[model samples]
Target: MEKAKEMVVGIKELSSLPAVYHQVRGVLDNADSSIIDLANVVSVDAAITARLLHVVNSVYFGLMSRVDTVSRAVSILGMQQVHDIVLATSVSAMFKGMSPANMNMTRFWSNSVMRALIARTGAEMVRAGELERFFVAGLLSDLGHLVMYEVEPKLAEQAQMLSVQSGRPLHELERELLGCDYAEVGAALVDKWHLPPRLGAAIAGQIEPALADELYRRDAAMLNLARIMTDAMEQKMESEAIAELFDESIWTLSGLKPANVATIRLIAEMNHGEVVTLFFPQLRPAG
Candidate 1:
């Protein structure tokens, strides 16, 4: 735990969330703050304003009317949802230049976006509220790996290689090799960044949802399934194979069945390309 803290602290400046995120968080934290206050903070950053409007207007929200202004978006989505969107957009922008040599930025971002979509889709299937939060959680779930690769590239690479060669879970190998896993590091990073505790808890306990606190156990379960689905997609496993990969406990925790995996994957895939391009435009191919 200390090691994880140290790593995050060491690279705090390099990995810090943008100032606008903090300002928006401040407004959200204040009960006295008005919708206009939050909107003003978000709108001040043109990039975030544009992206936030795009996401809110996108199929993700499925609102009947368009949300052209941040104030309108705030009014419709509420403070928490607006905060989630800002955090997601801010995070996407934060890591633009921090890709480590050992990682494929494009593939990494693709998988992250896929995991996010899968989690969001799974939440929708289960009738969960605050579906956008699920997407943010899924998108930021693998953040520990990015930080690990940056702070301890050699050890991180070794863990990955060993996981592949031994066919063991990467997080398990990471624990043995680095005395901490991506989940822990990721949780620590969010904590360091002053993100909501729910986000941190979901990322930390994603590997074993049963171990997470009761309040967040279901969220952890959702992320666990999302990771499985993302990995299965990456490996090109068939739908039956993907179903076979889900644990019964996870299905119970997430209120999802193996039968739902195909639909979730389809939804995630349909949105994957567009989201990847939205978050990481540099990856879009030349026309």
Candidate 2:
């Protein structure tokens, strides 16, 4: 863990979230902050404005009409939701160039968006509060892999190959070879970014939620299922095959059922392209 922390901290790219995100977060944390204050901070960045407007108008939100201005968006979506949207978009931008030689950025973001939607779906299905928080946590769950690949691409590749050959858990191979897995590295990055501690806790314990604190285990369990579901989708695995990969107790933890997995996976698959387009309008389909 120490080595992973050192590696992530030393990397310029992953060390901090974009400054604008921090500024917005400052207002979100301040009791005196108003919707206007948050709007002003967001409006400074044209890209975030466009993305925020696009998202609020997108079918994802299912707003009746277009939301044209940041101020209007603030009034409509409320501070909590807007903060998440801006942070999500800004984080996407922050890691825009973090693709390792071994991984494709298009595929990376696509998987993240899928996992995020799946997590949100899980949150709704389970009646877990704050769907957006689960979405962001799921989106960032795999971030540690970016740091690992950046610090040691060849070793990362080797771990992947070994996992494929051995039929063992990849995180196991990653920890054995790299001194830490993506979950640990991701947790470290989440801490450095000063995100909600739950986000970090969930990421850190995703591979083994049982090891996390009792309170966070529930959210971590949701993320764990979301990750497995997303990976199965990315690999184009069938539902039965995916079923074989699930933790029997995770469904219970998520307040879902075995049958529900099929439904959630189906919905996630159907929505994958549109959600990808929703978050990454600039990206084209990876053919």
Best by lDDT: 1
The residue-level lDDT of candidate 2 at 7 comes to 68
lDDT of 1 at 223: 93
Give lDDT tens digits, candidate 1, residues 181-218.
Answer: 99999899999888989999999999999999999999
Q: What is the C-alpha lDDT profile of model 2 across 1-287, one tens digit per residue?
A: 79778868878877677777889889989999999999999999898898889888887788988889999999988887888888788887777756688987788788888888888888888788778888888888888888887888999989999999999999999889988899999998888889989889999989888778888988898889888988877788877787677777786667777667778887777877877887776676988
lDDT of 2 at 279: 75
Per-residue error (Å), model 2, residue 17:
1.6
In model 1, the worst 10-residue window by lDDT is 278-287
Q: Scored by CA lDDT, what does every candidate get?
A: 0.88, 0.84
- Candidate 1 local lDDT, residue 239: 78
**Candidate 1 clash pair list:** none
